[model samples]
Target: MAARAMHVLTSRVGEHNAVILSQEALSNLVGCSERRLRDAVKLLAAENWIEIRRIGGRGTVNAYVINDRVAWAGARDGRRYSLFSATVIAVDDEQPDANELGQQAPLRQLPTMYPGEGQLPSGEGLDPPSQPSLGGLETDLPARRISPPAGSPFDDEK
Candidate 1:
Protein backbone atom coordinates (compact mmCIF):
# COMPACT_ATOMS: atom_id res chain seq x y z
CA MET A 1 0.00 0.00 0.00
CA ALA A 2 2.89 2.33 0.72
CA ALA A 3 4.40 1.51 -2.67
CA ARG A 4 1.01 2.17 -4.31
CA ALA A 5 0.82 5.59 -2.64
CA MET A 6 4.32 6.37 -3.88
CA HIS A 7 3.29 5.45 -7.41
CA VAL A 8 0.30 7.78 -7.17
CA LEU A 9 2.51 10.64 -5.98
CA THR A 10 4.95 10.01 -8.83
CA SER A 11 2.13 9.98 -11.40
CA ARG A 12 0.78 13.29 -10.09
CA VAL A 13 4.16 14.98 -10.64
CA GLY A 14 3.35 15.46 -14.33
CA GLU A 15 0.18 17.47 -13.59
CA HIS A 16 1.20 19.21 -10.38
CA ASN A 17 4.95 19.25 -10.07
CA ALA A 18 4.81 21.67 -7.12
CA VAL A 19 2.03 19.85 -5.30
CA ILE A 20 2.53 19.32 -1.56
CA LEU A 21 0.74 16.28 -0.23
CA SER A 22 -1.45 16.65 2.81
CA GLN A 23 -1.73 13.84 5.37
CA GLU A 24 -5.34 13.35 4.30
CA ALA A 25 -4.32 12.98 0.65
CA LEU A 26 -1.69 10.44 1.48
CA SER A 27 -4.08 8.54 3.76
CA ASN A 28 -6.69 8.37 1.00
CA LEU A 29 -4.08 7.20 -1.50
CA VAL A 30 -2.85 4.43 0.81
CA GLY A 31 -6.37 3.39 1.89
CA CYS A 32 -5.54 4.00 5.53
CA SER A 33 -6.56 6.38 8.33
CA GLU A 34 -4.78 9.71 8.63
CA ARG A 35 -3.06 8.60 11.86
CA ARG A 36 -1.80 5.41 10.21
CA LEU A 37 -0.61 7.36 7.22
CA ARG A 38 1.27 9.72 9.52
CA ASP A 39 2.91 6.75 11.23
CA ALA A 40 3.89 5.26 7.88
CA VAL A 41 5.33 8.62 6.83
CA LYS A 42 7.34 8.76 10.04
CA LEU A 43 8.70 5.27 9.38
CA LEU A 44 9.61 6.22 5.85
CA ALA A 45 11.32 9.40 7.05
CA ALA A 46 13.38 7.47 9.62
CA GLU A 47 14.53 5.13 6.84
CA ASN A 48 15.43 8.04 4.53
CA TRP A 49 12.69 6.85 2.18
CA ILE A 50 11.31 10.40 2.12
CA GLU A 51 12.02 13.91 3.31
CA ILE A 52 9.42 15.93 5.20
CA ARG A 53 9.04 19.63 4.57
CA ARG A 54 7.07 22.04 6.73
CA ILE A 55 5.00 24.78 5.12
CA GLY A 56 3.02 27.93 6.02
CA GLY A 57 3.23 30.29 9.03
CA ARG A 58 2.85 27.59 11.68
CA GLY A 59 4.14 24.54 9.86
CA THR A 60 0.56 23.27 9.51
CA VAL A 61 1.32 21.50 6.23
CA ASN A 62 3.90 18.84 5.35
CA ALA A 63 5.31 17.53 2.05
CA TYR A 64 6.96 14.23 1.23
CA VAL A 65 9.98 13.83 -1.04
CA ILE A 66 10.42 10.29 -2.30
CA ASN A 67 13.95 8.87 -2.02
CA ASP A 68 14.62 6.88 -5.17
CA ARG A 69 17.95 5.60 -3.90
CA VAL A 70 16.40 3.87 -0.87
CA ALA A 71 13.55 2.41 -2.92
CA TRP A 72 15.87 1.03 -5.65
CA ALA A 73 18.35 -0.24 -3.06
CA GLY A 74 15.60 -2.17 -1.29
CA ALA A 75 14.43 -3.63 -4.58
CA ARG A 76 17.96 -4.65 -5.56
CA ASP A 77 18.62 -6.25 -2.14
CA GLY A 78 15.36 -8.20 -2.45
CA ARG A 79 16.36 -9.59 -5.84
CA ARG A 80 13.18 -8.15 -7.40
CA TYR A 81 14.98 -6.94 -10.55
CA SER A 82 14.93 -9.10 -13.67
CA LEU A 83 17.04 -9.69 -16.78
CA PHE A 84 15.54 -10.72 -20.12
CA SER A 85 17.45 -12.33 -23.00
CA ALA A 86 16.36 -12.91 -26.58
CA THR A 87 17.86 -13.56 -30.06
CA VAL A 88 16.73 -11.82 -33.26
CA ILE A 89 16.52 -14.07 -36.33
CA ALA A 90 16.06 -11.84 -39.38
CA VAL A 91 14.51 -8.57 -40.65
CA ASP A 92 13.68 -6.64 -43.89
CA ASP A 93 13.53 -2.87 -44.38
CA GLU A 94 13.24 -1.82 -48.02
CA GLN A 95 10.38 -4.10 -49.10
CA PRO A 96 7.17 -4.73 -47.11
CA ASP A 97 7.79 -8.46 -47.58
CA ALA A 98 9.91 -9.90 -44.79
CA ASN A 99 10.93 -12.83 -47.00
CA GLU A 100 12.69 -10.41 -49.40
CA LEU A 101 15.69 -10.34 -47.03
CA GLY A 102 17.70 -13.54 -46.83
CA GLN A 103 16.98 -15.01 -43.37
CA GLN A 104 20.68 -14.80 -42.41
CA ALA A 105 21.53 -11.35 -41.10
CA PRO A 106 20.47 -10.51 -37.53
CA LEU A 107 17.23 -8.52 -37.22
CA ARG A 108 18.99 -5.85 -35.12
CA GLN A 109 21.09 -4.79 -38.18
CA LEU A 110 17.99 -4.13 -40.35
CA PRO A 111 16.97 -0.48 -40.85
CA THR A 112 13.64 0.29 -39.21
CA MET A 113 10.69 0.82 -41.59
CA TYR A 114 7.74 3.03 -40.71
CA PRO A 115 4.41 3.53 -42.48
CA GLY A 116 4.13 6.70 -44.62
CA GLU A 117 1.20 8.99 -45.46
CA GLY A 118 -2.10 7.74 -46.91
CA GLN A 119 -3.22 4.09 -47.04
CA LEU A 120 -0.93 1.14 -47.61
CA PRO A 121 -0.53 -0.49 -51.03
CA SER A 122 -3.21 -3.06 -50.04
CA GLY A 123 -5.71 -0.20 -49.30
CA GLU A 124 -5.31 -0.78 -45.55
CA GLY A 125 -5.68 2.32 -43.37
CA LEU A 126 -2.69 4.50 -42.41
CA ASP A 127 -2.14 7.65 -40.39
CA PRO A 128 -3.07 10.83 -42.32
CA PRO A 129 -0.28 13.14 -43.42
CA SER A 130 0.23 16.21 -41.20
CA GLN A 131 0.91 19.66 -42.72
CA PRO A 132 2.66 22.40 -40.79
CA SER A 133 0.61 25.57 -40.26
CA LEU A 134 1.97 29.11 -40.49
CA GLY A 135 2.16 30.03 -36.81
CA GLY A 136 -0.96 27.91 -36.20
CA LEU A 137 -3.12 30.26 -38.32
CA GLU A 138 -5.39 29.00 -41.10
CA THR A 139 -4.15 29.69 -44.65
CA ASP A 140 -7.25 31.76 -45.53
CA LEU A 141 -7.30 33.81 -42.30
CA PRO A 142 -5.80 37.31 -41.87
CA ALA A 143 -2.07 37.36 -41.02
CA ARG A 144 -2.46 39.52 -37.90
CA ARG A 145 -4.97 38.58 -35.18
CA ILE A 146 -6.56 41.02 -32.71
CA SER A 147 -5.32 41.12 -29.10
CA PRO A 148 -7.46 41.31 -25.95
CA PRO A 149 -7.95 44.78 -24.41
CA ALA A 150 -5.69 45.25 -21.37
CA GLY A 151 -7.22 46.09 -17.98
CA SER A 152 -7.44 44.38 -14.61
CA PRO A 153 -10.62 44.05 -12.51
CA PHE A 154 -8.85 46.06 -9.78
CA ASP A 155 -7.91 48.97 -12.09
CA ASP A 156 -8.61 52.34 -10.45
CA GLU A 157 -10.72 55.01 -12.15
CA LYS A 158 -9.67 58.53 -11.26
Candidate 2:
Protein backbone atom coordinates (compact mmCIF):
# COMPACT_ATOMS: atom_id res chain seq x y z
CA MET A 1 0.00 0.00 0.00
CA ALA A 2 2.83 2.35 0.88
CA ALA A 3 4.59 1.45 -2.35
CA ARG A 4 1.40 2.10 -4.31
CA ALA A 5 0.89 5.51 -2.72
CA MET A 6 4.54 6.36 -3.34
CA HIS A 7 4.22 5.44 -7.01
CA VAL A 8 1.20 7.74 -7.42
CA LEU A 9 3.00 10.59 -5.65
CA THR A 10 6.15 10.26 -7.76
CA SER A 11 4.14 10.13 -10.97
CA ARG A 12 2.55 13.50 -10.19
CA VAL A 13 5.85 15.13 -9.10
CA GLY A 14 6.33 16.62 -12.55
CA GLU A 15 2.91 18.36 -12.54
CA HIS A 16 3.26 19.40 -8.90
CA ASN A 17 6.66 20.49 -7.58
CA ALA A 18 5.86 19.32 -4.02
CA VAL A 19 4.02 16.02 -3.69
CA ILE A 20 0.77 17.01 -1.98
CA LEU A 21 -1.69 14.13 -2.02
CA SER A 22 -5.09 14.52 -0.44
CA GLN A 23 -6.20 11.63 1.80
CA GLU A 24 -9.21 10.96 -0.43
CA ALA A 25 -7.09 10.91 -3.55
CA LEU A 26 -4.58 8.59 -1.94
CA SER A 27 -7.33 6.31 -0.77
CA ASN A 28 -8.81 6.14 -4.27
CA LEU A 29 -5.44 5.45 -5.85
CA VAL A 30 -4.52 2.73 -3.33
CA GLY A 31 -7.93 1.02 -3.45
CA CYS A 32 -8.54 1.71 0.24
CA SER A 33 -10.89 3.81 2.31
CA GLU A 34 -10.04 7.24 3.65
CA ARG A 35 -9.55 5.87 7.15
CA ARG A 36 -6.97 3.34 6.00
CA LEU A 37 -5.16 5.95 3.96
CA ARG A 38 -5.06 8.26 6.96
CA ASP A 39 -3.62 5.51 9.15
CA ALA A 40 -0.98 4.66 6.59
CA VAL A 41 -0.07 8.31 6.24
CA LYS A 42 0.22 8.61 10.00
CA LEU A 43 2.59 5.63 10.12
CA LEU A 44 4.67 7.09 7.32
CA ALA A 45 4.83 10.40 9.14
CA ALA A 46 5.98 8.74 12.34
CA GLU A 47 8.80 7.05 10.44
CA ASN A 48 9.88 10.41 8.95
CA TRP A 49 9.01 9.10 5.49
CA ILE A 50 6.66 12.01 4.85
CA GLU A 51 5.83 15.40 6.28
CA ILE A 52 2.14 16.25 6.53
CA ARG A 53 0.75 19.76 6.74
CA ARG A 54 -2.92 20.51 7.26
CA ILE A 55 -4.24 23.55 5.45
CA GLY A 56 -6.85 25.66 7.22
CA GLY A 57 -10.31 25.81 5.61
CA ARG A 58 -9.26 23.15 3.10
CA GLY A 59 -11.02 19.95 4.14
CA THR A 60 -8.66 16.96 4.11
CA VAL A 61 -6.23 18.67 1.79
CA ASN A 62 -2.92 17.82 3.38
CA ALA A 63 0.49 18.54 1.92
CA TYR A 64 2.91 15.59 1.92
CA VAL A 65 6.65 16.00 1.65
CA ILE A 66 8.40 12.76 0.68
CA ASN A 67 11.73 11.87 2.33
CA ASP A 68 13.78 9.93 -0.20
CA ARG A 69 16.63 8.92 2.13
CA VAL A 70 14.34 7.31 4.70
CA ALA A 71 12.25 5.65 2.00
CA TRP A 72 15.40 4.18 0.40
CA ALA A 73 16.52 2.85 3.79
CA GLY A 74 13.16 1.18 4.31
CA ALA A 75 13.35 -0.39 0.84
CA ARG A 76 16.83 -1.78 1.55
CA ASP A 77 15.46 -3.41 4.72
CA GLY A 78 12.42 -4.93 2.94
CA ARG A 79 9.89 -2.44 4.24
CA ARG A 80 7.36 -0.21 2.51
CA TYR A 81 9.30 2.45 0.62
CA SER A 82 8.89 5.76 -1.20
CA LEU A 83 11.49 7.74 -3.15
CA PHE A 84 11.53 11.55 -3.58
CA SER A 85 13.73 14.59 -3.04
CA ALA A 86 12.52 17.70 -1.23
CA THR A 87 15.18 19.97 -2.66
CA VAL A 88 13.67 22.98 -4.47
CA ILE A 89 15.34 25.45 -6.79
CA ALA A 90 14.38 29.10 -6.47
CA VAL A 91 13.32 30.65 -9.80
CA ASP A 92 14.26 34.19 -10.72
CA ASP A 93 11.40 36.14 -12.38
CA GLU A 94 13.50 39.00 -13.68
CA GLN A 95 12.88 39.68 -17.32
CA PRO A 96 15.71 39.44 -19.83
CA ASP A 97 15.18 42.96 -21.23
CA ALA A 98 12.89 45.72 -19.95
CA ASN A 99 12.85 47.48 -23.30
CA GLU A 100 11.94 44.31 -25.21
CA LEU A 101 8.28 45.42 -25.02
CA GLY A 102 7.94 48.83 -26.68
CA GLN A 103 5.89 51.59 -25.10
CA GLN A 104 3.07 50.93 -27.55
CA ALA A 105 2.57 47.41 -26.21
CA PRO A 106 0.57 46.85 -23.04
CA LEU A 107 2.26 45.27 -20.01
CA ARG A 108 2.41 41.48 -20.25
CA GLN A 109 0.38 39.36 -17.84
CA LEU A 110 0.18 35.70 -16.94
CA PRO A 111 -2.75 33.65 -18.26
CA THR A 112 -5.46 32.45 -15.88
CA MET A 113 -8.14 29.77 -16.20
CA TYR A 114 -11.50 30.92 -14.90
CA PRO A 115 -14.28 28.52 -13.97
CA GLY A 116 -16.49 28.99 -17.04
CA GLU A 117 -13.66 29.65 -19.49
CA GLY A 118 -13.09 26.98 -22.11
CA GLN A 119 -9.72 25.40 -22.73
CA LEU A 120 -7.18 27.98 -23.79
CA PRO A 121 -5.28 27.55 -27.03
CA SER A 122 -1.87 25.86 -26.78
CA GLY A 123 1.48 27.74 -26.71
CA GLU A 124 1.00 29.19 -23.24
CA GLY A 125 -2.48 30.57 -24.09
CA LEU A 126 -0.96 33.31 -26.17
CA ASP A 127 -2.81 34.11 -29.41
CA PRO A 128 -1.37 32.09 -32.29
CA PRO A 129 -1.34 32.97 -35.97
CA SER A 130 -4.16 31.38 -37.96
CA GLN A 131 -2.74 28.77 -40.29
CA PRO A 132 -4.40 26.31 -42.65
CA SER A 133 -4.84 22.84 -41.19
CA LEU A 134 -2.27 20.23 -42.33
CA GLY A 135 -4.92 17.51 -42.66
CA GLY A 136 -4.80 17.81 -46.47
CA LEU A 137 -0.99 17.33 -46.62
CA GLU A 138 0.32 14.58 -48.93
CA THR A 139 0.85 11.39 -46.89
CA ASP A 140 2.49 9.40 -49.70
CA LEU A 141 5.92 10.97 -49.12
CA PRO A 142 8.33 8.87 -47.07
CA ALA A 143 8.88 10.17 -43.53
CA ARG A 144 12.44 9.91 -42.15
CA ARG A 145 12.95 9.93 -38.40
CA ILE A 146 16.62 10.48 -37.46
CA SER A 147 18.13 9.77 -34.07
CA PRO A 148 21.52 8.76 -32.65
CA PRO A 149 21.97 5.07 -31.76
CA ALA A 150 22.55 3.88 -28.18
CA GLY A 151 25.69 5.43 -26.64
CA SER A 152 26.79 6.76 -30.04
CA PRO A 153 27.02 10.44 -31.14
CA PHE A 154 25.63 11.66 -34.44
CA ASP A 155 29.16 12.13 -35.84
CA ASP A 156 30.68 8.93 -34.43
CA GLU A 157 33.32 7.53 -36.83
CA LYS A 158 32.28 3.91 -36.25
Candidate 3:
Protein backbone atom coordinates (compact mmCIF):
# COMPACT_ATOMS: atom_id res chain seq x y z
CA MET A 1 0.00 0.00 0.00
CA ALA A 2 2.90 2.38 0.72
CA ALA A 3 4.25 1.62 -2.73
CA ARG A 4 0.86 2.57 -4.21
CA ALA A 5 0.64 5.69 -2.06
CA MET A 6 3.98 6.90 -3.41
CA HIS A 7 2.42 7.34 -6.84
CA VAL A 8 -0.34 9.68 -5.61
CA LEU A 9 1.55 11.30 -2.77
CA THR A 10 1.27 15.08 -2.83
CA SER A 11 4.06 17.53 -2.09
CA ARG A 12 2.27 20.86 -2.17
CA VAL A 13 3.27 23.62 0.25
CA GLY A 14 1.04 22.36 3.06
CA GLU A 15 -0.23 19.04 1.60
CA HIS A 16 2.92 17.06 1.83
CA ASN A 17 2.55 13.27 2.15
CA ALA A 18 -1.24 13.39 1.78
CA VAL A 19 -3.10 10.78 -0.28
CA ILE A 20 -6.82 11.19 -1.04
CA LEU A 21 -7.55 7.77 -2.44
CA SER A 22 -10.85 5.99 -1.80
CA GLN A 23 -10.83 2.88 0.35
CA GLU A 24 -12.18 0.76 -2.48
CA ALA A 25 -9.67 2.21 -4.90
CA LEU A 26 -6.82 1.66 -2.47
CA SER A 27 -7.94 -1.93 -1.89
CA ASN A 28 -8.04 -2.54 -5.63
CA LEU A 29 -4.62 -0.94 -6.01
CA VAL A 30 -3.11 -3.02 -3.20
CA GLY A 31 -4.82 -6.16 -4.58
CA CYS A 32 -6.46 -6.95 -1.24
CA SER A 33 -9.97 -7.24 0.12
CA GLU A 34 -11.53 -4.18 1.70
CA ARG A 35 -11.64 -5.93 5.08
CA ARG A 36 -7.95 -6.79 4.86
CA LEU A 37 -7.21 -3.22 3.84
CA ARG A 38 -8.99 -1.92 6.92
CA ASP A 39 -7.05 -4.30 9.09
CA ALA A 40 -3.79 -3.15 7.57
CA VAL A 41 -4.74 0.45 8.06
CA LYS A 42 -5.47 -0.21 11.71
CA LEU A 43 -2.09 -1.88 12.11
CA LEU A 44 -0.30 1.00 10.46
CA ALA A 45 -2.06 3.48 12.74
CA ALA A 46 -1.18 1.48 15.81
CA GLU A 47 2.49 1.70 14.79
CA ASN A 48 2.22 5.45 14.07
CA TRP A 49 3.05 4.77 10.44
CA ILE A 50 0.09 6.90 9.29
CA GLU A 51 -2.77 9.04 10.52
CA ILE A 52 -6.27 8.81 9.08
CA ARG A 53 -8.10 12.14 8.89
CA ARG A 54 -11.44 10.91 7.60
CA ILE A 55 -13.19 7.53 7.32
CA GLY A 56 -14.83 8.62 4.01
CA GLY A 57 -18.62 8.31 4.36
CA ARG A 58 -20.96 8.35 1.35
CA GLY A 59 -19.88 10.73 -1.45
CA THR A 60 -16.60 11.38 0.35
CA VAL A 61 -13.12 9.95 -0.02
CA ASN A 62 -10.97 8.59 2.80
CA ALA A 63 -8.10 10.96 3.62
CA TYR A 64 -4.76 9.67 4.88
CA VAL A 65 -1.56 11.46 5.81
CA ILE A 66 1.47 9.27 5.64
CA ASN A 67 4.01 9.80 8.40
CA ASP A 68 6.86 11.69 6.78
CA ARG A 69 9.13 10.18 9.39
CA VAL A 70 8.56 6.86 7.63
CA ALA A 71 7.97 7.78 3.96
CA TRP A 72 7.94 11.11 2.12
CA ALA A 73 8.20 12.23 -1.48
CA GLY A 74 8.36 15.99 -1.05
CA ALA A 75 10.95 18.49 0.02
CA ARG A 76 12.12 17.99 3.63
CA ASP A 77 10.79 21.41 4.64
CA GLY A 78 7.30 20.66 3.31
CA ARG A 79 6.86 17.42 5.25
CA ARG A 80 8.80 18.44 8.31
CA TYR A 81 6.13 18.94 10.96
CA SER A 82 3.59 20.04 8.38
CA LEU A 83 -0.18 19.53 8.15
CA PHE A 84 -2.35 18.45 5.18
CA SER A 85 -3.46 21.31 2.93
CA ALA A 86 -4.73 19.69 -0.32
CA THR A 87 -5.73 16.28 -1.72
CA VAL A 88 -5.15 13.97 -4.67
CA ILE A 89 -8.42 12.33 -5.70
CA ALA A 90 -8.59 9.17 -7.80
CA VAL A 91 -11.77 8.75 -9.89
CA ASP A 92 -13.26 5.35 -10.73
CA ASP A 93 -15.67 6.17 -13.51
CA GLU A 94 -16.71 4.86 -16.91
CA GLN A 95 -14.51 5.33 -19.93
CA PRO A 96 -14.43 8.91 -21.21
CA ASP A 97 -16.56 9.72 -24.27
CA ALA A 98 -14.85 10.48 -27.56
CA ASN A 99 -15.78 14.13 -27.23
CA GLU A 100 -14.36 14.29 -23.72
CA LEU A 101 -11.19 12.72 -25.10
CA GLY A 102 -10.63 15.87 -27.20
CA GLN A 103 -10.41 16.45 -30.94
CA GLN A 104 -7.78 14.97 -33.29
CA ALA A 105 -7.03 16.32 -36.77
CA PRO A 106 -7.64 14.02 -39.70
CA LEU A 107 -4.60 12.41 -41.33
CA ARG A 108 -3.59 13.61 -44.80
CA GLN A 109 -4.10 11.22 -47.73
CA LEU A 110 -0.74 10.47 -49.36
CA PRO A 111 -0.28 9.66 -53.05
CA THR A 112 0.22 5.96 -53.78
CA MET A 113 1.72 4.05 -56.69
CA TYR A 114 1.82 0.34 -57.58
CA PRO A 115 4.96 -1.58 -58.49
CA GLY A 116 6.31 -0.83 -62.03
CA GLU A 117 3.70 1.92 -62.34
CA GLY A 118 4.12 5.55 -63.55
CA GLN A 119 7.29 4.66 -65.42
CA LEU A 120 9.03 7.51 -67.32
CA PRO A 121 10.05 7.00 -70.96
CA SER A 122 13.71 5.82 -71.29
CA GLY A 123 15.03 9.12 -72.77
CA GLU A 124 12.53 11.61 -71.37
CA GLY A 125 14.23 12.19 -67.94
CA LEU A 126 17.68 12.53 -69.65
CA ASP A 127 16.69 15.85 -71.21
CA PRO A 128 19.45 17.78 -69.46
CA PRO A 129 22.69 17.95 -71.51
CA SER A 130 25.27 15.43 -70.21
CA GLN A 131 28.04 18.08 -70.33
CA PRO A 132 26.99 21.69 -69.82
CA SER A 133 28.10 23.85 -72.84
CA LEU A 134 30.86 26.31 -71.91
CA GLY A 135 29.89 28.73 -74.71
CA GLY A 136 32.86 30.80 -76.02
CA LEU A 137 35.03 29.79 -73.03
CA GLU A 138 38.63 28.63 -73.68
CA THR A 139 38.89 24.80 -73.23
CA ASP A 140 41.76 23.83 -75.54
CA LEU A 141 44.50 24.13 -72.87
CA PRO A 142 45.54 20.79 -71.15
CA ALA A 143 44.97 20.60 -67.35
CA ARG A 144 48.21 21.50 -65.51
CA ARG A 145 49.47 18.68 -63.22
CA ILE A 146 51.66 19.75 -60.27
CA SER A 147 54.09 16.99 -59.25
CA PRO A 148 54.89 16.26 -55.55
CA PRO A 149 57.85 18.24 -54.13
CA ALA A 150 61.27 16.40 -54.26
CA GLY A 151 62.45 14.55 -51.08
CA SER A 152 58.83 14.45 -49.76
CA PRO A 153 57.41 11.02 -48.65
CA PHE A 154 54.75 11.34 -51.41
CA ASP A 155 57.58 11.34 -54.02
CA ASP A 156 58.75 7.88 -52.76
CA GLU A 157 55.24 6.27 -53.36
CA LYS A 158 55.51 6.86 -57.14
For model 3, residues 37-152, the per-residue Cα lDDT tens digits are 77777777677766765633472356667655323355675544334444665453522553544456677544444343343224333333233245785236557877789878
Q: Which candidate's lDDT is highest?
A: 2
Tell me the spans in candidate 1 whose CA falls farther than 4 Å from its real position.
15-18, 57-60, 67-158
lDDT of 3 at 102: 40
Query: What TM-score, over all chains together, does every model reach?
Result: 0.36, 0.40, 0.39
For candidate 2, what is the lDDT?
0.58
Model 1 lDDT per residue over 1-158, tens place: 55665665566545322235556655676798877777776776687766656545554345555533212223665655422221111223324775655665565333323353232333335532344344656346446754444575554532
Q: Which 10 successive residues of model 2 have the least lDDT summed?
A: 86-95
| Candidates 1 and 3, the one with greater TM-score | 3
Tell me the deviation in Å of residue 77 in model 2: 45
